[model samples]
Target: MTMDTAIARPELLLVADAVAREKQIDREEVLEAMEQAIQKAGRAKYGHEKDIRATIDRKTGDVRLSRWTEAVETVENEETQIPIHIARKFKPDIEVGGHLVDPLPPIDFGRIAAQTAKQVIVQRVREYERKRQYDEYKDRVGEIITGVVKRTEYGNLMVDLGRSEALLRRDETIPRENLHNGDRVRAFIYDVREEPRGPQIFLSRTHPGFLAKLFAQEVPEIYEGIIEIKAVARDPGSRAKMAVISRDSSIDPVGACVGMRGSRVQAVVAELQGEKIDIIPWSPNPATFVVNALAPAEVSKVVLDEEAGKVEVVVPDTQLSLAIGRRGQNVRLASQLTRWDIDILTEAEESERRQEEFRRRSGLFVEALDVDDVIAGLLVTEGFEGVEDLAATPVEELAAIEGFDEGIAAELQRRAEVALERKATELEDKRRALGVADDLAGLEGLSPAMLVALGEKGVKTLDDLADLASDELIEIVGADAMDEDAANAIIMAARAHWFEGEEDAG
Candidate 1:
């Protein structure tokens, strides 16, 4: 058929005027559809997010198109083609090996899908516009936004973020923070994405930074840089600790955050529904910093291990229990803020930890414990099956064995001492590390056989008993068969090692 026949028959467009009569959409949109349809039929395929332009006659709804290319010497394929002579018509200067794109319209556009494709092209354009909007917002994730609560659906809150709806997940809600219809809520937009529905923006109030940003919004000193938030830790809806500092000596960071008569903080607290806010002054000195972090608790001394990033906080015997907190929460948060391992204890426990460190760092472990790793090699020649069996034989008895020499025997004795001490120390240290408090005294009172039995059960040190309360001791030692006082006596005896022996002697 000729080009005129194809134009009269039309493609999926049905008729040039059908757009004005039926789809009720602007005539421009229908023209865009026809242009896109003709462009797609010329290529005979749908192209994705690409930059191919098309022009449709506003009057006839017929279209033409082209893609950008440079004039090239060798034409690998045929889509965008230009003879070297004809290419100079568009460009005054053109090269043979360069690129060129020549405009072309389908001679028989109606030969492709006629009416059906016109409808599909319009739908594709609508879908593309939706995606365009989504792409514009997807990169704007993790921004704080103000949005009205449009409504709640399937437990997910849909917020109208002006041009888009952002999803506020159920878990991200500040605990007990409710929303009313049309209530304008301020939230941190945690994420944005493209989905079938549209742009998906995830908001969060439980996020700790949300509190910091909220304060920044409400406090001018912070926004303007007179005051800055150094650290923020939060248990949303319950309490938060924020450390602030001031660049200007005249401005008090804490006072600025707290505002006059607690007014500034009260506004944030009210937004959080009476959640407590502690505005602390930031400190450069780590020990001072930590004492501040463990607020409400009196710290006697703060010993920090700089290389290992560990802190040992010594409190008075009276404050030890409180400094450590319920389930050790106070020290735990302090550890997170300071980015260090924190050991919280009474003054007495601090002294013992130092003593334990001395024992572990002593030369006994270096030369002495070196023998443990290769004990298997020595045993192969000497006929001992395992470490415990070799240990059961005294140093002198092992010295008498065929392959053993005096120096090797002596080294073995030292290894045993360090190994046994370390094993006991580790058992004790593990308990202390678990946020359990123990007495500074050692364990004793148990009979020698019972002591040996306890070693077999891995209760090698007094700290082990400290980690376990009286009930745990009973549970392990089988109080089932023992009389009540006997079980209680055994428990007391187990803890007697670290204490000094009684004054009177036989």
Candidate 2:
């Protein structure tokens, strides 16, 4: 190409404008890329070791090339740096560390140099496009976006999302859902990450947020913030459960999400390829929420074990199959929606288990308190769980039980205290036999029974207990004995020696 075409090429500005418009990127970015390409070609024409630079005038599209050398007190490199005395001789007011620039004649583009310049421009433009895509999509995470399927690779779909392409991985697609090139699809933008190859925009059709977003689009009440989605659980293409709450008491959240004749939910289900959805009203009461989550099956009773994050649901005998769903889908989804572990039982099974527990506790009272079956049964019926409960109860409270007076209540409390003392002595003997340390036994949260249990598990030293995580300690001592917070405190207490050693050494 001629020097005038290469130097004052107004066509270069037109090309940058066209590329910037097509890529949906800033025109300034395109100009910067073009300058880099010209600078690379200039460096190839000049010596590679010299610092060659190029710039394009924004208004006229006039390209200028120059060589730069730094004036340093010591000449470190022959090509890029010059001695301060020589630099000052050329530019009379030059200071050390300042750069000196020399204008050069425009380069005549050879075939290889033209090809190299094109590659550099293309690569820079691609990098700018990638950055633009990342910046645009990163904050759009958790939103639902529509795109056309561009192609597929190894069961993954590459979707053209207007200006950028996103990958819907095989596992992120709803099971058995099919898409072909040019097919319109809607998915959730779950993540955007910059990777080695390029910025990756990850889309998911099976994400629970996708279902929630669909409801928001279809239900005006939800979109306007009158109704809110609390939680969602999906088996993806099979079934899903969503919990919703209404900020306005007059509007029913579930009814509003269902829309007129189920239009709203049906739209979401159709998009998910016939995935069945159950929309339930959410409650602040976890028990009520869990009962609602297990839809289509009537729950007779709900019991929560807060420490373990577990709930027990009792349904009638006929509702067992429906409550658990096919292969436990219903209960599993309910558990996930409520963030609880669910154990389902029939009414008959629950009643049988209650009777069995009554018998066991009554038998213990009878053996330990030397009471008759009638008296022991009465204690168990009155909610006295063990000898500890009986000993802890006030004599007046014990005497308040029907068919009991002050004399009987006093005798019972005395016997309960004796039994507890005997149990503690036995546990302490067992703890000693197991070589449990005295310091561990004296830990504030640990009881005699817990000490013996820990000793049996070989956690007999403070260091051993300190090494255990809160969950590990709970598992060894029994979750029913202490919750995670108490376990963590006990472990922290055990670790006190470690910090003490550090202080001494310091």
Candidate 3:
């Protein structure tokens, strides 16, 4: 057929336009998809080994098919590249890196060729649609999105969010939340990822962020930025805790969130299937924040060990169970909200533990320094927890203590040194008996006790110590005994030999 007959196929352009409008994609991409489909059909008709290509006129919908090869100095691939010498025969001015095109006859839409073209067009269009969906929803992550449950496959719910499908994994759903097809759901778009099948949007109804967004929706103060949700923790369908702070000093953030007659928080609670919510006022002080987080349970005292990131909360005997909650849910959510490891103790338990510690320290001092109970009691009362601290105390510091004369201080110091020496000798014997290496024992940060502990755990050699991660070492030694940075330093010291060996080999 002539160009006039081919141009008569204006229905081709109409199809591209209709598909672009239906798919809500760019018309140019649709045209490109059509061009690719035609090129594929051309390749099927001709030899597949040839570098066949196709193009469609944007306005006229005229389809052109051709075979192209790159002009190169040396043709490595014979089918797709031509030697510069041969390329110059067609165009004398042809140069390397230039393309040479040979037009092919217009393709007749045979049954198989037309089917293959349709498949190519459909596949390419679907790919573009997937990419569009991914781009559209990727930015919506962490925002609240509403969708309808399309279906459930193996406990995973596929939700239709208008343009794309989102996955609500089994674990991400609120506990005890049941849904069937066509159930409307609101969730937090936690993640959007591209996969082999398509763009996968991961939604979560149980995420703490979901609760926060719900509060923002129900409370105008939060949405308007007058109140800020500092942190949220959820038991998901059971209970949740949210900490809020107000930018305006005159505004009460907790009250604003609760609203008049509890209307604001009630809406969020209803959406969460009647999950109890504690709207605590956030504080700049971690202790005060933790105290507020553990509301409905009075806290008498909070002893914070910042180094260990743990808080000891003491409550009255009656409030102990309330503070701990049934199965410890209250304190667990409080810990999550405050970002601290909380240990709840009743007043009686705390007092008993204090007395026990007092006796333990007094006994330790008496045994180590050969002092009387009265003197040891005085040392213990002076805030000495261990003999190591007593021994490390400067003479001036000891003399400053009440009833500690210079001579008494000097005697205490001498006794402390002697006791430590004796303990070290015993630890050294224990370490040797356990076959702990001398090099590991000699490491600066590894005390005699730590060396003995390592030996007991089968980490005797420097190499063995080097093999342990910081967390593993912290596990072996208690968190209070060593922190991540100190443990990492010790591990790096243990690894020094490896580098030395490398230098020696070099």
Task: Give the residue spans of candidate 3 off by over 4 A.
Answer: 1-7, 394-400, 403-407, 421-443, 446-506
Expressed as tens digits, the lDDT of each residue in 122-222 for candidate 2 is 99999999999899999999999999999999989999988999999999998888789999999999999998677999999989999999999999998
Residue lDDT tens for model 1, 1-506: 22331233244345535753553344555566667665555455434332355666554545556564545555554444556666777776887765554454444536445554666676765665566557767776656789999999887788887756788887888788878779998888777677786567789887777888889988999989888888887777876778889999998888888889888899999888787887778899988988988887898997888966888888989987677766776677666666678888888887787667544444333443564434435553465543445566787877887677877877776666666676767655554444333332234344333344445556656666545555655656555434446655656665565454653432
Model 2 steric clash pairs: none
Question: For each candidate, C-alpha RMSD in Å?
Answer: 18.6, 3.2, 3.2
1-506 per-residue lDDT for model 3 (tens digits): 43332333567889989998999888888889988988888888888888899888877778788889999998799989999999999988988999898888888889999999999999999999999999898898899999999999999999999878999999998888898999999999999999989999999999999999998898888889999999999999999999999999999998988999999889998998899999899999999999999999999999999977999999999998899998899999999999999999999999999999999999999999999999899999999878788889999999999888989998998999999999999999999999999978888887888888888899989999999999999888777788889999999999998899789989
Minimum summed lDDT over a 10-residue window in model 3 is located at 1-10
Best by lDDT: 2
Off by over 4 Å in 1: 1-34, 41-54, 57-142, 151-154, 180-183, 193-199, 351-506
User: How many Å off is the CA of 440 in candidate 2?
Assistant: 5.1
Give candidate 2's error at residue 61 in angstroms: 2.8
Model 2 Cα RMSD, Å?
Answer: 3.2
> Which is the winner by TM-score between candidate 1 and candidate 2?
2
Between candidates 1 and 3, the one scoring higher on TM-score is: 3
